[model samples]
Target: MKYLSSGTKYDSCNQSAICHAFGPDGRCIQLYKTLLTNYCSGECTYCPNRCERDVTRVSLSPDEITKITWSFYRKNAIEGLFLSSGVIGEPEITSQKQLEVATLLRQQGFKGYIHLRLMPGTPKYILDQIAEVANKFGVNAETTNKSNYSEICPNFDYQNDVLQRLHWTDRIIRKKRKEFRGTNRLVGANDTQFVVGAVNEPDSEIVNTVSEFMKKYSLRRPYFMSFDPVPDTPLSENRPSPLWREQRLYQVSYLLKEYGIKADDFDVVYDEHGFLSNSDPKLELAKANRDMFPVDINSASFSDLIRVPGIGPISADRILRSRPLFEEKELTRMGVVVGRARPFICINGKSQASLSDFLEACS
Candidate 1:
């Protein structure tokens, strides 16, 4: 309940749950995110619902879940549903219940977005059924590597269970895309979540693993969840992962997924411990390559524009799209952070702002 109620926005489909989702027509839509049931049989060391102790076990029937979701949807409380559940008896059993909710919603003409979790080891047929009704799918890889998987979630298989399910999700979504031809039923994207700092995995491994997935599968992006120790769990004695580390990962992920920034480029920000430092990755890169400063916004390439501190792909493209060009003040209007970008950008092939100015302004 602590985790759920925290309402910490997760990076799913390039949007946060705290901020509402935009519909196809650009309307904002709220999502009702919840778990189907908290019951589980797996003994993942970090999970509160792991089968070791006498935790409260609760399960909601598929019909009950559908009623609650439908009621909310009809009343305009939510525009969609984000449903997940721990493995009840088997992966298939839990998956079937989720599929039921999706199917029922679709049958009732509920066309809003539905993000469903693909349970590990779920059969291909069940996955196909889920693809028919879901807008996006998620399978949490939790850790970076198989070796780390043993240290963290020993009950689950890294290859056959986790990776294979991700593979199936990619394949099914592709097949659905071909079948639907960009219809609403076509699942737009898939994502994975990683338990950052668990099993002592470094940021490099986590980013690299997600990069590999992006290359092979049709993965949209990866979500980073800071490891928070739950009471009575085996990992309760371990130190909780710093939230700043998770925030750093998200920034790095945006650079990789949105800005086309390569994962190898992260070597510039990683410390001796192989973890990302508290400094923002973009600022660190800028600090390291001082020669690239004072980029001409009017003449700089799209790639170079993104390398600047406060300019993103969208704002950079907006700058490029302007016909008559823009003044220094106009940069902020185009969504550029003038305060952060001033030192790094040149308005008319002239450098005015300095590192000292940037430091002082930032301070």
Candidate 2:
């Protein structure tokens, strides 16, 4: 249990459940997170279980995984399973093994939430089989694009293997939901993940790729796993990507998904290297586009309001509903962080702050 769980942590399924929230039907409450096996054949340079690395390897059978899950479930120790794996051999073969695990668990009368991650090249047929039992499915894109695979994961054909499988998962899930539409039973959600800083790409590239994904593929979410160089891997001597970089990626993704912010809106926030600075991205964007500031509270559209530093969609909605007024306190009362938004917002045509006021407040 310990070895398998540790091996799968690098997958960062919900940052290994540390900094994410899961609240539907309490299905994720105490999930039994682990890998089907730690033995792997792929020679990815960053993984401890890569074919070139020397490490203790273990694999659990479908029956074993099913039994262990039920033992924990019966003891009230867990409510669901989040199972991923080290690629045992071919992608489809490894996925079939995991499908067997989920198949056995279901046959055992365990009707809990099961999240099975498909290997990058796993085909649609096997994906169809697995979706019968798993509620959520994901395939890790691993990095921004195919070019980066040459650096750390040369064996992967990023477009055909990773990107295509993601498309397949999305299509399959959508088709299944459509078939089940009138039954009030939507059973599948799909997500993709990336390893931050592994291939030396900028945040702009990451943001743009993720924006394309959310727009084109209807990606439910994008996961960013901070790349911590593992000892004995080829990249072991390289510095680990900071956790804050991973956090920034999440913030950018949220801005893309919920705020309806375009990827180009973030272009100005990037430094010369095309990376976001170690700061709030929204604030940086707002500061960079200073001319758009001092937006009228009463007349600004929802789109304009969310572009401000401290005003989020919720507060923006509240402001809209309670609008045609005067006073900064109303903004604060509606949930805007007054200190952050005050410099950029105007109430009833009364501009709140000047350049000196902003500079003085900072000083």
Candidate 3:
């Protein structure tokens, strides 16, 4: 279990203030994310344990995982369990092992959040059983589309295995919400991850796919894994994706989610190669659309206020609720990042700082 736990860091669902998983109630949780087994049969080029890799293989029985999860939850060491696994044999067989662990936890009176991984192409019947005990679930798409999956994981089917399962998970979550009102324990479009820079696909395609998923499947958001070559795997020598690229994608995605920034809005954010420059995406967007900046700090709507580089939803709403600002320092009190927002906003129709000054700094 110790070694298996280390491998799960690849999945974005395992985040932190140290394993920080946010519950349905908007509380951050420490999820006991660990692999059910590290043994595998798939031959994916990027995986460390893709059947052919020489690594120590281990499997924890369903009963064993249940004990581990329960012990953690009881002691407040963790608030949840996120059970994922490598394909020990068939995908379905491995999925069953995950379900059994959740079942045992539920039976043990584990009321905390339980996030189980749904293997690609898991049949609807299995989804139903898993949903009964699971508060949330995920299926990593790994990449943007079928063609991309072919390059990195030739044996993995992006459609039947990955996308179809995503479609099903969305439906089940919706159905359960109707059957049991106020019981929608789901978050995300059931959530997914993509290995950014895994292929030569543009950031446009990645963000576009996530936007489409959000619209079509009610995806709350997506997590990105900046590609880092693993030793002894097929991609070991490939250049690792810069951490800034991952950070840029997250900012762009956040804009898409919170500020309703659309794909077309990002056209200038990319270069000739269709990649974002290593810079603040929000500032880039404001710079490109100069007319939109210098928005009246006091009168700007919640939507327009958040469009400013340093002003977020929280500060935007604060500005809205407490209006008619008399001084610039008031902006700071409401949580606005005054330094960044300086060039993009005005108070009492007075520009905070000339836009030319900001542009000069960027150069």
Q: What is the lDDT of residue 258 in candidate 1?
A: 90
> What are the runs in model 2 whose C-alpha is more than 4 Å off?
14-30, 74-79, 182-186, 356-363
Best by TM-score: 3
Positional deviation of residue 31's Cα in model 1 after best superposition, in angstroms: 2.7
- The TM-scores of all predictions, comma-separated, are 0.88, 0.90, 0.92
Expressed as tens digits, the lDDT of each residue in 1-363 for candidate 3 is 887987786766643335444657453558888899999888888888788899999888888888888888778778788888888778889888888898988898887778887677677788888888887887888888899998898877998888888888999888877777765454323788889987889998888898988887777768898898888888888988998888899889899998998988898889998899999999999999998878998777888899998999999988998888977799898888988998888887788656576899899
lDDT of 1 by residue, 1-363 (tens): 334312223323333443354657443447766677777778888877778856666766667767877888778777677788778889899888889999988898887778887677788888888888888876789998888887888777989888998988888878878888855454566688998876798898888887888887867778888898878888999999998998898898888889888888888778887898888789898877888877887788999999999999889999999834557778878999987888788886656766687899999
Q: Identify the superior model by TM-score, candidate 2 or candidate 3.
A: 3
- For model 2, how does the per-residue alpha-carbon lDDT over 1-363 read when each residue is reduced to its tens digit? 889977765564442333223445232335778888888888888888888788888988888788889988787766667899888878888999888888888888887778887787898899888878787787888888788975777777989988888888888888888878888443666688888987798999999999988867788689888888989998998899998898898999889888988999898999999998889989988999998987888999999999998999999999889978688877778889988988888887777657677899999
lDDT of 3: 0.83
| 1 or 2, greater by lDDT | 2
What do the candidate models score in CA lDDT, each in turn? Answer: 0.78, 0.82, 0.83
